[model samples]
Target: MSLRTTLRVKTPPGFRVDASALLPVRLAAMSVAEIERIVLPAGNDRCIVGDVFEVSRGEATPALEAPHAGATLVIENAAPWLDRVGARMTDGHLVVHGSTGDYSGFQMAGGVLRIEGDAGHFTACEMRGGRLTVTGHCGDFAAGALVGDMEGMTGGTLTIHGNVGARLADRMRRGLVLVGGNAGEFAASRLVAGTIGIAGQLGAHYAYGMRRGTLLLTQRPAQLPPTFTGGGRGFDVFWALLVRSLAGEIAPFSQWHAASLPTRYAGDLAVDGRGEILVVS
Candidate 1:
């Protein structure tokens, strides 16, 4: 049989649900029916599965597992301000039909989060694992680190189809972020490791104080950090593999595989770093 859980909170004022705290652990080895029965917090009182949602049990179908396997969670029409629906989840698949609040996948370990609409700021802050794909635009710090923190995104992948706000990957340590449209200033500031690939132009000061990591651009950048030094020009097979791996998440980037080889630059010599920037020639 299949399992389904639908939220029933219609006009609950100021009632926010912290679904992230329950994920990965609660979703593992459980079916949809089992997921619906789990209790959800509502401010002061507790709510049961039948009280706040409508659940149906059936066999697993392609709709539920279209993106992947594991305990698939399909959230529909969650009102605005429902922040952190799936934070720190280690496994499972979470699908949201509408927009998501801030810190959608903060510190997530594994699993897949697909938001069909826009996402708020700090969308995937400090994400360690898993994959978060947003269809619409996002606010500032799309995949950045915590404020005043040195280490940014550690692991995982964040794919955005629409434009993103400022400081996309500031202080990123490890992981992969793919932006289909333009990005704001300081895109990869102080990036220690990992990669940030943008299919459009970077806003300004694209990479500043970047100690390590790779930033890929599809168009001619208006401005490049002075610290970065030109490394002549060369192609890397690893870039091809990265593009291939992200093809499904970012459809347009697939063309890079057949396009001309890009020019690579190494920089942040101010800190004696080894970060790199790759732009389409």
Candidate 2:
């Protein structure tokens, strides 16, 4: 028998559904009947998985392996009302065929979470470790700290193929975020440590209060804050290493030559002042 489980939505939920409980690791142990009985929070009410989806089992793909005995889980016909699609998932693969609501991969520690469509706000908030990819646009606060939290994404890799909203990585302690399209304002506010790459234009007040981190931009912004200044050099070795490491990650950056160095600005001088912003020529 195949170790893959598929959940096809029978009907779009009229209210937002908290689908966090339906994780790959947990589902891999359940029988088809048991999976159907699983409960989910839908708005102010509750519903069982069988009420909204048709469950089936199929062959597993070689590309994805669970940390242990768990099998991969696939959600088909996913919609924006499905929230927390892979929250706290530790192992295994989870794929969403359509859009998802807020906190799509909240605190994910391991495994792969792939969203084929856009993701809502706080898409990967407080993520500790793992790989999360959103093929379409993402809303604000991705890889950022949640309200009342002191830290954002501590470790992980987040890749967005489309534009992103404001506060892209607020208070991020460590991680890698790549955006293929434009980014909104305050792209790396108060960033403590991490690497953020944006291939398109950046909005106003970007890198505001950034303390220690690297922000790679393919296009120069309209203006940079006065807190930042130029004259950074002697980092050819670091630039070459970075370019080589990112050569397979995203475009423009992936196409950069190791010998070419970009313009560097150091700042958010009002604070730690150790952060660096590299603008590709």
Candidate 3:
């Protein structure tokens, strides 16, 4: 059996709550009483966990070894006022059962963070390593740089089952981002190095200033930027390998046939100009 800790919100807070400190690995070592006493930032005021949530401990069905030693934490009845849900988490499994505010999974370095509902802006900003899955749509700047930060999402895997807002993966350095629905403007803008796959419609200025990286799209845009030029044949081997690797990921990537090659365009020539955009027909 695995140790499972649950934090159920008793009432929605009038002010935003910073829940970054309530990580799975840290809470697993504490008793219920200890957890309840933990202080969390609420707007400008501080509140103890017990004051805002009902804490409980239970045994969860056993599963294969987890990334963080099988420790699990569940945030029940999560709301949009809950910010920084799993900031800087290094290990363990954390699940948010509802919507979350901005900066969810900010700079997380390891383990798995799953959001059952929508996530606000800057989700997974500057993330280093780990896996973050959002079942619903995400607001702007998901997996992108934080304000003046030079890099975003250095490593890890981010999967969004629904639509994504603007500036997706902006300044991203390294990682894999897969979106199941449409994306807003400036997707992959200034991307340094990474792989982003979108299965739906793209907004204007997509791949605006990409330097080095790969952007995979299932739907052709209304207009391909003039800076990008068609890439001639010769990537059949790479295409085969890429399709094979994505076979296990979300559709339509998983459904792609390795034998077929996608339409390739290379540019953002305005910059280092090495990035590629592959449109699956």
Candidate with the greatest TM-score versus the true structure = 3
For each candidate, the alpha-carbon lDDT, in order, equals 0.75, 0.90, 0.92
Candidate 1 vs candidate 3, lDDT winner: 3
Which segments of candidate 2 are over 4 A away from where they belong? 63-70
Instruction: List TM-score per model, in order.
Output: 0.84, 0.96, 0.97
Q: Judged by lDDT, which candidate is best?
A: 3
Q: Could you tell me the lDDT of residue 183 within candidate 2?
A: 92
Q: Predict model 1's lDDT versus the native.
A: 0.75
Please give the distance, in angstroms, between residue 124's alpha carbon in candidate 1 and its true position after superposition: 1.2
Candidate 1 residue lDDT tens string, 212-271 = 888888776766677888875445567667667757666556566634567888988887
- Report the lDDT tens digits of candidate 3 across residue range 20-111: 99998899999999999999898778888998899999875555225535688999999999999989999888888999999999999998
Residue range 68-162, candidate 2, lDDT tens digits: 53569999999999999899988888988999999989999988899999999999999998889999999999999998898999998999999
In Å, residue 227's CA in model 1 sits off its true spot by 1.7
Ranking by lDDT: 3, 2, 1
Any residue pairs clashing in model 3, and if so which? none
